[model samples]
Target chain A: MASVRNLLVFRQLFHKETSTYTYLLACKQTMKAVLIDPVLDCVERDLKLLRELGVQLVYGINTHVHADHITGTGKLKQALPDCKSVLGSKSGGRADIFVDQSERLKFGNLMLECRSTPGHTNGCTTFVLHDRAMAFTGDALLVRGCGRTDFQQGSPSTLYESVHSQILSLPKHYKLYPAHDYKGFSVTTVEEELAHNTRLTKSKEEFIKIMDNLNLPYPKRIDESLPANLICGVTDPVSS
Target chain B: MASVRNLLVFRQLFHKETSTYTYLLACKQTMKAVLIDPVLDCVERDLKLLRELGVQLVYGINTHVHADHITGTGKLKQALPDCKSVLGSKSGGRADIFVDQSERLKFGNLMLECRSTPGHTNGCTTFVLHDRAMAFTGDALLVRGCGRTDFQQGSPSTLYESVHSQILSLPKHYKLYPAHDYKGFSVTTVEEELAHNTRLTKSKEEFIKIMDNLNLPYPKRIDESLPANLICGVTDPVSS
Candidate 1:
């Protein structure tokens, strides 16, 4: 078993088409790794990256049920036989393992603390690595902007509460990595989000107004992604 | 009713994420149109374009079952009550309407001739319009490079034969429109494809070798796209 602090491998990968950020984490000694918020369109790229790093994928984790794109967890689970698929219990009860907020997922001697962050979607979860070094904030929080709360069971008040207590309460240095970003911005810290977040900087009332006024078009593949994601991206024998 | 040559409304729309070219053809006088290879992700964009152009969507057509992206035909049918979905009978029996080679599709006063171009897929069809003024050659023919015939029931000899008899036999000045193109190059003429297509210009044996050695990875969303597209992008209540 590898010590959690000794050797950690973390790579943040971006899928240009969808502007999605997939995180790869591994323990050097065990060669076991975990992937977070994988996109269906970038599976080969992710697999190639794992091969180059000489790591064996063991877990596929989802921050939430994404609306803009299909999750690659199902595909990864099929490709890597030993890999287990995981998502929050609130996230529609799909995946091989449905985890709750207090549950910590362990892989190669390292553990990820799952925190309920259900604003962007009813099942969104933020995963905190050992000692709160970094957090995967899914759509709940972005660098300078928070996820839009206009649809998919989203509530502006709930998002504000989730971010303030569950995320902002962490030590200011803890890094915040979000699942999607359209602009070229990278990771941000709790301190920076607290000070500079465009949406979070506003009061709760203002945040609600902003959410109501966004008027953004529904995501491109929402119709296809939602239907396929509900079944974990596998063929429905009867449907065909 | 508009004359076929005097009042043709054709717009080639591009989906940047997938680099797919969706063609919208209409009779300007009747304001009736049909869309070819409509992408699921761009349904809203397509609908908006139709509304802006003040044309009534009468049909959504597929050149074949796509592996790269989900078709928007199913969603378009739901949005536009009058729209009908069409595909080649060999592609699968999922679409609302299926026609074989020699069938002419009519919308308003214009008609498109269906020609079998099966090499990339068993059901691939090339559509010719207005005395072969233009043709939508799906994956059978590309601009500077023809589609790779390594999978999906592909055969180099079949592609060569099909292109020669159905596409190349047309007028030299006929415009060639492909379903998808990664490079920026757009419509090419039959004469240009005969001269410049890297794959088609080769002999049958040489073309087979090129396809075998191309070594392209399987599409990222094949698993999800294939199953969903097989059923015309409709939601399977049982699966979901």
Candidate 2:
């Protein structure tokens, strides 16, 4: 007999070249699955795992139009014809489904509440699994650091508010999974981030000043990534 | 208002330089924790996380003495004076507690059943958290792959037997976490691996042949890692 208490099937995958984290989540009973932030280079790997798990890929969801690696949603749709490509409407990216703020996306017996968290990008959204007390934070809130606010419609003040109001206000113990982590941390809690987020924990004025002074070099792949991502990562010229 | 059903607190940490994974598991009620496969370079990071989580470190266990990276168990013992260093007795490594086959180590409300699954190394052991239906496979088994059998007393036949008899025999749904993954996979299931493990799925004779012909290059850090690990990864000349 299967246990009803633990019905969420979850796996965390990585793309080493880009330091991206792709998540596979499914409802144990129905095996209906969703892939959050899949990477273009890992489409085959993702497809193989999905097949092995025997889960039906209902949605290939991206948290935002990534500036690093191209999104795998388009490729995933090609592999699984029934799977829909999903993105935030504000992202200015094409998708089969453009979700709005506070929208509920259901797969199997689980529901994910989409919250717009646009500090990283206008379309950046955090998907919250309320019952599981987990949030797929994308770039809004990393383990101890938030995303850079220098590009892709980024704003320090806007990001600051988005994180505090949309993410931190959740229960202190809620697990936050980020899109990318260079330090190897897989997950963090709202409580830990509230206490130690190097950038976001500071006053808004200080945070703005810090983000302003970062002066980091432009992302190496932004030009290619942004355009590719706008089309939902479809590389084939004939179809995309 | 704490939920009694979800008393286990878990985190999967990674060390990018070596592609190693360190896991933190604790009993929520008692706040007693154990770290599996900690790396020397990430000691400070691990300690800070432990302090922030407000959990007392009880045991620092190593799945095996790694050839790729030095274990952080000794450094952890130095920082958390109450925490004991644990390793398999067959591993021939010095530790505060040398667990034997079928030994159960208790930390708060949880117990890990250590099963000797040596093929990657004589001391390799897989720790199974029975309640959670998960196993931490050191190097004997990996995601669709197994550890290289070119050196460090590696024997493909022994590994095949260990994986098939000891690890694979667990319930099919049991999740298996490996000590290291180069391709960005974090977890797999007994069923998935049984169907997909490239090397172990082969017959013992074929598996041995494949391993023998791997012709892999010598591990770059093995010379330094082995000696340091034998002493539990403590580099200080005075205390060690």
Candidate 3:
């Protein structure tokens, strides 16, 4: 078996009480790594973890323009000027690299293949580390339910298609890492999500109907979250 | 049996997704009315209801400075320019008539006795319609739980004191009308609240411990809602 490496998950609670999760994937042998969906203040803790793990931060990737918490990508980039900030081309944010669907990202011995999901938002993406049999599904496929599709250009049908065609098609054993979870339970699998997720388990039409019935009121922080998220969690510099 | 007027409860879903409940209490014979925690946009509908019921809108009261939706007190004042905007003095917002603990506000045949219940905020108040055997408890008390004490300068101990001293002291038969509830179930009695409310039923120390354990994250719209609520729910200058 290939040598085991330490993967650290940093979860940060943000904004009026919302929880955000950030992941650090590293290969012990080469000490190269990538981060996903990181919160701004948690970057310091992540850097500390990186130093202790003897890992070199190489890339930062955001799944989408999150509507709950500020992204830490820009701040991380500022701290580690050499590291590249990467995101899906449709993210409409400033990034070192605008990745497209099926784009493979390498970190020493590890590989993360980006898959466009686009259900919760117009530009949502899930990164699959094929070799490790792991997939960071972000907000696309949550444990028991699905991300809401009532705001930020979210389409229930499109999300359903993204889940079935893009995420579910992956290896059944691939471990899923979502963005936010109240319970400490961190990981699940494609098979589990397909079977238990109330939102993803339904037929596309049924999913739409279910989503329609579960029509939640607009997110309380949408106006505040979207503007910051659209800029990849960076507030525009105000002129003095 | 004394002639009874059916007690009516109003639930108004407001903001992009947040729900707010406003109530209208009326004496069927005298046609006098009192408004509780009114959301601005729903004022017109409430006025229409009052017209249909032949009730005069005499007083407007707010539960607290809401962090989800704007209050309709100012709007109602504009519609009925002579109507009094009544509220607790601690609300930190301007009102035509500031009420204090046990202060009885008379409206023709109905009487609303103010009860200071500071826990959700320093100024939160509940209105007891004494003669009708009803009380508008607002966020301080919910069916199975109490208003969270982690926001807007909330204190668990203060909440405990308010519950024990102000609310629980009321007569067992007094019905409760909260400012927000989605289940369409309205009106819980003082006896029910004292017995069933998880937050209120605990001993002072136990209640504090439970609240401490709750350490809830902030409300989603707090940043947006506070400014509006601070101004008595007026986002802009009142239009004549």
Query: How does each model score on lDDT?
Result: 0.81, 0.91, 0.72
**TM, every model:** 0.50, 0.95, 0.48
Instruction: Please tell me how candidate 2 rates in CAPRI terms.
Output: high
Across B115-200, the per-residue lDDT of candidate 3 in tens digits comes to 99999887789988666677788888875577888878788999999977888788976777777644323346677667667578
| Residues B20-92, model 2: lDDT tens digits | 9999999998999999999999999999989888999999999988998899988898888899989889888
Candidate 3 steric clashes: 5
Off by over 4 Å in 2: A1-5, A237-240, B1-5
Question: Model 1 over residues A125-192: C-alpha lDDT tens digits?
Answer: 99998443789999899977888888888998999999988898889868888897664344677877
Q: On lDDT, who's better, 1 or 2?
A: 2
Q: Provide the lDDT at B180 for model 3.
A: 60
Model 1, B1-240: lDDT tens per residue?
A: 533465676666666677677989888778899999999988987787677557999989998888889999888988997998888888864988897999999888778999998888878899999543889988889876777677778887888888988998889868889887664334667876777677888888988888888889988888988887887887665763
**Full candidate order by lDDT, most accurate first:** 2, 1, 3
Q: How much does candidate 1 score in TM-score? A: 0.50
Better of 1 and 2 by DockQ: 2
The better-scoring model by TM-score among 2 and 3 is 2
Sort order, TM-score high to low: 2, 1, 3
lDDT of 2 by residue, A1-240 (tens): 755447898999999888999999999889999999999999999898888888999999999999988999888888888999899999999999999899999999898999999988999999999988999999999999989999999999999999999999999989999999998899999998999899988999999999999999999889989998998887684855
